[model samples]
Target: MSPPMIIAGIVVWFTAGSLLSWHARKNLGEGMIEYFLADRKVGGFISAMTYSATTYSAFMMVGLVGLTYSSGIGSLGFEMTYLAATVILMVIFAPRYWAAGRIFRLVTPSELLARRYRSPMAGAVSAVLCLVMLVPYASVQLMGIGYLLEVLSGGAIPFTVGMLIAAGVSFVFSWWAGLRSVALTDALQAVVMLVASLLLLGFITLALFPGGLPEALGSRQDLLKVSWTFPMFLGLTLPWAFFAVTNPQVVQRLYIPSSVKNLRKMILGFSAFGFVYTVLCVVFGLAAAVKIPGLEKADNAMAMLLSSVPSPLALVVSLSITAAAVSTMNSIILTLSSMFGRDVVRTFLPDISERTELGICRLLIPVITVVCFFFARMQLGLIAVLSSMASGGLLMQLPTILGAFFWKKATAAGAVSSMIAGGLAVSFMYVQGLKPLGHWPPVWGILVSGTVFIAVSLATRPPIDTEDFFSSLEGYIRDSFGS
Candidate 1:
C-alpha cells in the first residue's frame, strides 16, 4: 500500500472517531465519577466492546498473529487459558469491585486497596507499581504502530510520525470526554478489529487457500499439536491468567457497569467476544504459517501477509490495528492518570479539592503519552514480553486484591510488603534477564510476594475496621443479590 492511501485511511478513521468522541462529550456530566467511569451507566454491549478492545490490543493482530504463525497452536491454548481465567476471575471479583466502587466512591483500583487495607501507602505503592510496569506495555503499542505504519507506508510515514499519530489520537480521545469518549471510540474500534480480521481470514482461506487451511497446512500439521514446554507455557500464561484482577486498566472496567446485571452481561459478553476473537487470531497465525512459510523472523509474519493481500484489505486491517493500539494506550494513560491523581497525589495532599485533582489528572495524560512515545522510540527488545511482563510485574498486586475480599487477617503492611517485594522481584528478573532456578521471573515474584504477604500479616495487626469492612462488603453482596 502507498503512503498516500495509508495516510488517507487513518485520517478517515480518526475523523469518524472524533465525531464519536464529540457525541459522547455532548452528554458528559460533571465530577470525577462521571468523567472517569461514565457515571457507571455504560450499556452492556458498549462495556463488553470497550473491555474487549482494551484487553486485546495490537498484540492480538500483530504480536499474537505472529506468535501463532511462528509457534503454532500452543499460542491458542495460552490465550484461551487467559480467557477462561478472566471469565472465572470476573465472576468472582466483578461484583465485589462493583459493590465496593459504589459504596466507597472509588476512582482507581489502587484507591480500592487504600480503603480496603486502610493504608494510603499501600495504595500509593501499588499505583507506583502500576505506573512503572504499564509504561513499557503501553509503549509496545506505540512501537507496533510505529513499525506497522513505517513498513506498510514504505518509509513515507516514518516511525516517529506513527508514534506521534497514535499518541495524539490517544491523548485527544482520553482527554476529551474521559471514559465516555474512550468507551464510545472503543466500540467503534472493536467493530473494526473484528470485521477487519474476519475479512483478512476470509481472504486467506478462500482466496489464498482454496483447498482449506488444514489441507494447506500439509506437513506443517506439526503446528496443530501443542509444542510449548510446560515451563515456557506456564511462565507465559500465569500473568495473563490473572490479568483481569491485576492490570489496573481492565480491573477498572469492572467498576463501569450500571448494575450487577450489566456487570454480568459485560463479563459474559466479553467472554464470548474473547473466544471468537482468540480463535480468529490463532487461525490467522496458522494461515500465515501455511501461506508465508520459512520467514526468517516469526514476528514479521503478519507484516508479510499484509503486504501480499489486496491493498484495500490491507489498509482496513492496518487501521484496525492502529485502532487497537490507540485504544489500549488511551485506556492505560487514562487509568494511570486517575491512579496518580486519586491514589498518588492524594496520598501526599489529602485535602485537595475534586476540581484540583481532576486538573492534575488531565495534565498528566499528555505527560504519560509522551513518556510512552519516547519509550517506543527506544525500540526495546522487550516488546513481545512487555505485555506479559507488565502483567507479571503487576502480579504483585494480585495478593492485595485477593486479600481485600477474602482474608480478614490481611494487613495493610502485608499488602504493602507483598506488592513492593513482588514488584521488585518481577522487575529485577525482567531487567536483568534472569529466570532464577528454572522458574519464570513472575513465578518467583508471586512466590516471594505471597510469602511476604502472609508472613507480614501474621506479624502485624489487621486494619482496625477489618471486621466492619468484611461486614459491609458481605452485606452489600447479600443485600444486592439476595445471596
Candidate 2:
C-alpha cells in the first residue's frame, strides 16, 4: 500500500472508533459508575469482545511474532499453554466472580477484595499495584501503535507522533464514555483484528508459498511440535491462568455483565474465540518464519513479514495492529483511572465527592497518556517484558480469589502475604532479567508465593476481622442453599 493510503486507512479506522466512542459516552452517564463499570449493564456479545480484545492486543501481533521469530515453533507451545490457562480461568472463576460482582455491586476488583477481606488496606494495596503495573503495559501498547504507524507510513509518522495520536484517541474515548466506550470500541477492534489476521494469513500463504501451508509446516517439523518440558509449561501457564481472575483490567470486565447468565455466555464465547484466535496467530507466526527468514527481533517479525508482503495486505494488517493497540490502551487508561480515582484518591480522601473523583479520572487519562508516550519512545520489548512483571502478582491474586469462592481457609493475612511476596518475587525476577543475571527467572516465584500464601494462612491465627471477611463471600454460595 502507498504511504498515503496506509495513513488514510488508519485515520479512517480511528475516526470510526472515535465516533462509536462519542455515541457510547453520550448514552452512558458521566459518574464513577459509568466511568468504571459502564453502570454494570454490558451484554454478552459486547462483553465477550471487550474481554478478548483487551486480552489479545498488539502483544499478539508484535510481541508474539517476535517470540516466534526467536523461538521458532517452540513459541506456539507456550501460546497454546497460555490459552489453556485462560480456559481454566473461565471455567473455574468467571461465573462465580461475575455473579458475586453483580450481587454486591462491586465496581472495582479492589472493592471486592476490600469487602471480602474486610480490610481497606488490602484493597488499597491491590489497587495501587494494579495501577502501577498497568501503566507500563498500557504504554507498551501505545508504543506498539507508534511503531506500527512508523512502519506502515514509511517514515511519514514518527514513533512519538504515532504514540500521541493513539494516546489521544484512547484518552478522548475513555474520558468521554469510560468503560462503555472501551467495551464498544473493543468489540469493533476484535472483529477487525481477527479478520485482518485471517486475510493476511491467506494472502501470505497463497502469494508467497504455493506449496501450501502444509508444505511450509512439513519443512519445519521440529518447529511445529511442543518442545518444552512440563516444568516449562507450568512456568508459563500457571501464572497466566490467574490473569483472568487477578488482572484488575480483566476482572473489571466481569463487573459489567448485564447479568450472571450474560457473563456465563460471554465467558463461553470468549473462550472459543480466544482459542481460535490464538491458534490462528501462532499459525501466522510459523508461516512468517518460513516465508521471512533471518528476522532480527521477535517483536518485529510479523511487521517485517507484513511489510514484505503485497502493499494492500500490509496496509490492512497495519490498521488491524493499530486497532489492537488502541483497544488495549483504552482499557488500560480506563483501568488506571479507576485505580487512581477510586482506590487511591478515595482511600486517602474519603470525603471527596463521587463527581469530583470522576473529574480526577478524566484528568488522569492525559497524564497517563504522556507517561506512556515517554515509555513508548524508549522502544522496549512489548509482551515478554510487561508479562514478566505481572505474571507473579496476578498469580498471587488467583489463590485468594479461588479460595474465597471454593476454599474455606483463605484468610486476609494469607491473601496479603501472598500478594506482597508474589509481587516482590515478580519484580525481583524482572530486575534480574534487566541485569546480567543468569537465564530466564525460574518459575520458582509461583511455587514460592503459593507456598507462602498457604503457610501464612494456616499458621497465623485469623485476625478479629477475619469473620467479617468470611461473611462477605456468603453470597457466592447462597445459590446452593437458597439465600
Candidate 3:
C-alpha cells in the first residue's frame, strides 16, 4: 500500500467515470425529469445496475463482511432475507410505482405520497425525514472510502483527503448528467465491484486455504454456524427487509426504468447481482474469520485481509470498495436533491418553474455532498450506530408507504404521526441505548409507529379523495401491467 498506488487508483476511477458521464450527457435533456429520473427512459440493464449499485453500498464489503466475520451464518441469513424480501416487495410495489409515476408524472416518492394522501404537508414531512435520516447514511459511504484509502495508502492519503476525493467525484458526476451519469457509472462500478470481489476471494482461497473454498470454510465450521439470538437477528433484519420502501434513494429508483418490462428486468437483474455479491461477501467474511483472527474491531477484517494480500491486488480491491462508495454516494445525493426540489421546495412554491426547480436541485447536489463530507470528517464512532439508526429510523415510514398503496382509510395525520413518532422513538432509543422490553430499537419503533398510525387514522377522517385516488391508481396499474 503506497501513496502512488492510491493516487493511481483515484486517477483511473475518475477518468473512467468522466468518460461515462460525458456519454450520459450526450443524450441528456435540460429538464428535471431528464436529469433526476433519466426522463424515465432508461433501459433494463442500466436500470438494474443502478438499482443494484445504489442498494448495495460500501456496507456490503465493509459492513456485511465484518458482520459475517464476527457473527457467522446469521449474517448470510440476514442478508438473504433482505434480498428475498426486496424481490418480493419489488414484485408488488414496482409496478404500482411505475404506474403512478407514469400516470401523474411524479418526480419523487414524496410526490407520490403527497398526491395519494392529498397533503403537501405529508410530502414535506417525508422529505424532511429523508434528509435527516439519509444524510448520515450518505456520510457513512464517504467515511468508508476515506477509511479504506487511509488504510490502503498506509496513511499517506489522510482520511479527510479521501473524503474530499469521494465527495468531489460524487458531486461532479451527479452535477454533470444527474441520474443518467450516475446510472451509467454505477453499471460500470457494479461490474468492477463484482469482479474485484471474485478476484479477491480467489486469491485468498489460493493463498490461505491451498486446498479449496470448501476446505477453508469447512475448517471454520464452528464459525459458519448461526451465532445470533433470534431477537438480535430480527432487529437487524427488520430494517433491511423493508429497505426497498424505507430508503428514499432505492425507492426513488422504482420510478426510473423506462417501462414495466424494464422494471421487471431491473428487479431480476438486481436480484442476481445481489445473490452473487452476498455470497462473495459472506465467504470473504468466513475466510477472514479463519485467516485473520483476533482483530479487535470487526470492521477491520476487510482492511486486514487486504493488507495481507499482495500490493497490486489489494490496490484493485481497494479501488473496488472506493467505487462502491462513490456509486452509492452519487445516487444518494441525486435522490436527496430531487426530494428537496420536488418535495420540499415545490411544497412551499407550487408555482415554481421547472427550470428553477432543476437549477435548485443541481445546486444542492454539491451542498449536500459537502455536508456529508463534513460529517464524515468528524469521524464519530457512533457513525456505525447512526447507519443502523437510519435503517430503523426509516422503517417508521413503512406503515405510511404501505397504507398509501393499499389502505384507503390511512389519513395524512396518521402518515405524519407515524413517521414522526417512529423516527423519534427509534432515534431516541438508539441514542439513549434503550431497548424497550429487551427488544431491538427497530422492533419497538415499528410497533409504536404502526400502533400510532392505526389509532390516529381510525380516530380521524381519511383524505377526501382517498377512494378516487385508489380507484384511479388501481385502474392505471391494471391497464399498465395488464394484471
Candidate 4:
C-alpha cells in the first residue's frame, strides 16, 4: 500500500472526527459535572456506544488478535471470561455506582470511596494508584497505532510518528468539551469499529477463505486446542475478570446514563457489541495465523495480514484500528484527569472552586499525553501482557472496593494499607520479572491486599457513617422497587 492511500484514509477519518468534536463543544454544558459526566443526562444509545468504545480498545484488534495468533483458543477463553465477568459485575454493581454517584454528587469513582469510608486518604490513595498503573494500559493504545501504521506502511510511517498522531488526536477530542466531545467521537468511532470489523471478517471469509473457517483451518486444528498453562491463564484472566469494577475509565461510565432505564440499555447494548467484537478479533487472529504463519512477532500478525489485502480495504481496516486506539486513549486521559482534580487535589484544598478544578483537569490532558507518549516510545513487551499488567497492578483496588460496599468494619487504614501494599507488590514483581510460585503478580497482589484489608479492618474501628451508607443503598433499592 502506498503511503498516500493510508494517509488519505486517516485524513478523512480525522476530518470527520474533528467536526464531531467541534459540534459536541457547541452543546457542552458548564461546570465540572457537565465537563466530566455529561451532566449525567446522556441518552441510552450514546451511553452504550461510549461505554463499548471505551471498554474495547485497540487491545481488541492489536493485542487480543496477536494473543490469539500465538496462544490459540485459550486466549479466546480468557477474553470470553472477561466479557462474562464484566457483564455479571455490571449487572450487580452498576446500579449501586449510579445511585452512589447521584446521591453523593460524585465526579469520580474514587470520590465514592471517600464518601463511603469518610476518609479522604482512601480516595486519594485509590486515585494515585490509578494514575500510576493506568499509564501502561493507556500507552498500549498508542503502541497499537504505532505498530499498525509502521507495519502497514512498510516503515513509511515511523512508529513514533504514529504514536504522536494518536496522542494528539486523543488529547484534542478530550480537550474540546470533556466527556461531550469524547463520548460523541466515541459513538462515531464505535460504529466504525464494529462495521469495519464485520466487513473485514466477511472479506476474509469470502475472499481469503472461500470455503468456510473450518475448511480454511485444515492443518491448524491444533490451534483450536487450549494450550496455555493453568498458571498463565489464571495470571492473565484474574485482573480482567474484575475490570468493570477496577478500571477507572470504565467505572466512570456507570455514572453517565440519564436514568436507570438508560443504564439498563447501556449494559445490554455494550454486552451485545462486546460479544461480537471479541469474536471478530479472535477470529481475525486465527485467520492471520493460517494466512501468514510463523511471524516472529505475533503482534505483527494483523499488520502482515493487512499488507496482503487490497490496498483500499487495508486502508479502511487500518483506520478502524486507529479509531479504536484514539477513542480509548482520549477516554483514559479524560477519566484520569477527573480523578486528579476531584479526588487527589481536592483532598488537600477542600475548598477549591469548581472552575479551578475543571481548569486543572483540562491542563493535565497534554501532560498526561506526553508522559504516555514517552512510555509508548519504549517499545514495551507484547501488547497483551502490558495491558494485563496494568490491570493486574490495578487489581489491588478490588479489596478496597469490596470492603467499601460489602464489609461493615472496613476502615480507611485498611483501604489505604491494602492498596499501597498490594500495588507495591505488583510493581516490584513486574519490575523484577518475578512470578512467585507460578502465579502472576496480581494473583499475589490480591492475596496480599485482601488479607491486609481483612486483618486491618478487624483491628481498626469502622467509619462513623458505615450504617448510614449501607442504609442509603438499601433505601435506594427500596425506592427503586417501589417505583
For model 3, the superposed segments whose C-alpha errors exceed 4 Å read none
The candidates, ranked best first by lDDT, are: 1, 3, 4, 2
C-alpha TM-score for every candidate: 0.98, 0.91, 0.98, 0.97
| Cα displacement (Å) at residue 244, model 1 | 0.2
lDDT string for model 1 (262-334, tens) is: 8888998899889999999898889888888899888788889988899999999999999999999999999
- Prediction-by-prediction clash tally: 0, 3, 0, 0
| lDDT (Cα, tens digit) per residue for candidate 4, span 103-132 | 889889999999998999999999999998
| Runs of candidate 1 exceeding 4 Å displacement | 380-388
The list of candidate 2 runs beyond 4 A from truth reads 229-232, 379-387, 434-442, 459-483
lDDT tens readout by residue for model 2, 1-483:
466787688778878888998889678866777678888888999999999888888878877777765666666777777777777777666666666676667677887777676666667878877866777778777877877787777788888888888888888767767888889889998999889888887786778778888887787776666676666566665666567777887888877877766777788878877887777777777877787777666677787787678887777788788888888888877887777777778878989888998888888888887887787677767544764666555666666666566555666787788777877777777765632223234365656667887898897654465555445546564663244
Top-scoring candidate (lDDT): 1
Give the poorly placed runs of model 4, Cα more than 4 Å off: 378-388, 481-483
RMSD values for the candidates in order, in angstroms, are 1.2, 3.0, 1.2, 1.6
